[model samples]
Target: MGTSEFMLAGLVPGIAQTLDVSLARAGYLTAAFAAGMVVGAPLMAALSRTWRRRTALRAFLVLFIAAHIAGGLTTSFAVLLATRVVAAVAYAGFLAVALTAAAGLVPPDRTGRALAVLLGGTTLACVAGIPGGALLDAAFGWRAAFWVVALLCLPAFAAVSRVADTPAGGVTDLRAELRELRHLAGALLLAALVNAATFGVFTYLAPVAAGVAPVPVVLAAFGFGCFAGITAAGRLADRWPGHVVAIGGSLLLTGWIVLALVPGALVFLVFTQGALSFAVGGTLITRILRQATGAPTMAGSYATAALNVGATAGPVLAGAMNPFRVAAALVAVALVSAVAGRSGRPAGPGRPSRSRRR
Candidate 1:
């Protein structure tokens, strides 16, 4: 699913040529997927609330696979765009359900690690899948990449079938989930702000590093940093989520500022920013899950929505202003938000404090 979501960027030129659409129009396919994720996360979670986790996951994979196949075979740009949205909706629901189920499989103390493992797939996609898709498109065609993604989903479907059919717990009421979301508004906001900072800089990274370093090397550095950050976050977040957020946010803010001030350090700053961003991001996710124990079925959906909101908004925000400076400002706001949330109240009503949890 992660591969399918991101691989489209590399194939946009080919798609535009084949469909006789403008490059800008072909780019809408990416935005459409993000929009679908933002809308579909909560929508699909609500619709599938009554099903077993395993069942919901399988159902989503089926839809996702069919959408990919349909997209690959379609010659009409409109039909292809519709298939992207459908696939994104399935991807959103599968991600939400999978995260919730992954957390359930682990003990409370190990929840951070479990979430990290699940999120690793996405980071890996950035590091590898995007390039692989490009290779496939070069050797075969753009449609071949879509077909490959559909084929990959088959194994995922079979794997999900073997997982335990855990009941989707917690109150199934949408009203109840909304109430939980209110209590979680602060954490969710923090998640959005941090990702906005991350993606705002990342979307413009190639141009930002124009002469300082090769694009491929700069991207590789950032991807490697993401992998390292997530690996460390899985362990640290379990014990010191607050500290992780504070320190990671500070580093991210500093990295962005340095990049803005000294454009020559673009490569190094991109790596540090990526590391700090994902570290804070992973910790924030664990924090949200801990606070949303009462809304187990909807927690992942809320997180997905918040993250995609940032992903969609970040590029638009960056496109309007100086990307690095904009990113730095966003991270500063996120840090302030995190600090205020920590100093104010507990994560949510009836949740245990960190001291008590330990």
Candidate 2:
């Protein structure tokens, strides 16, 4: 799903040419997917509140696979765009359910590690999937990439079908869930701000690193950093969640500021910036989940919604502006929120205090 969301950027020229649409029009596919995710996360979580985790997972996977197949077979741009949105919605539901299920599988203290393991697949996708799709497109045309995604879903479907059914977590009342979500608003806002900073600069990485290094090399470095950062956060977050986020945010803020002042250092900065960005991001997600014990079923949706909101807004906010400068400013705000909002507080309206848990 990560590949499907990001691969479109590389294939936009081909898609535009084949569909006889302008590049600007073809770009809408990416935006459409982000919008779908933002809208679908909470909506699907609420709608599937009565379903077993296994059932929700299987159903969404089917939708995702079917959408990919339909997209691969379509020639009309409008049809293709519709398929992207459908696939994104399915992906959103699947991700939310998967995260909730993953957390449920672990002991409370190990939640961060479990979430990290699940998110590792997405980070790996950044390292390999985007480039792999580009290669597939180069060799067999853009449609081939979509077909490959559909084929990949088959094994996932088979694997998910084997898991024993488990009841969905949290209260079934939609109003209660919404009220829980409100308590989590501060963490969610910080998440959106952090991602906006990370992705805003990332959206224009090629131009940002114009003379410093080639695009593929820069991307590989950045992806590797993301993987490393998340791995480290998985181990550390359980012990010192606040410190992880704070230190990562500090590094991210510093990195972006340096990039703004010293554009020549982009080749090196990209790797460090990627590490810090995802380190902070991964920690923030774990924090939100840990704080959301009261709204376990809706926890994943809250996190997903926050991320998609940032992903959708970042590039738009950075448009025609100095991306590095914009990223630094955004990170500054996120850091302040993290501190002022008391992101590391042990309890909220629906949660048990650390002392109570003990």
Q: Supply every candidate's count of residue pairs whose N, Cα or C atoms clash at under 3 angstroms.
A: 0, 0
Clashing pairs in 1: none
After superposition, which runs of candidate 1 have C-alpha atoms over 4 Å from their true positions? Answer: 346-358
Please name the candidate that would achieve the greatest lDDT relative to the true structure: 1
Candidates' RMSD to native: 1.9, 2.5
User: What's the true lDDT of residue 244 in model 1?
Assistant: 89
* Tens digits of per-residue lDDT for model 2, 183-282: 7898899989988887787788867777888988998888888888888888788778878887878988998999889988887777788888888888
- Best candidate according to TM-score: 1
Q: How accurate is candidate 2 locally (lDDT)?
A: 0.85
Encode model 1's per-residue lDDT on 201-317: one tens digit a residue.
777777777789998788778877877788789989999887888777887888888888898988657677777889899888888888886687899999999989998899899
Q: Which residue pairs in model 2 clash with each other?
A: none
Q: In model 1, what lDDT does residue 131 have?
A: 77
Q: Which window of 10 residues has the lowest lDDT sum in candidate 2?
A: 349-358
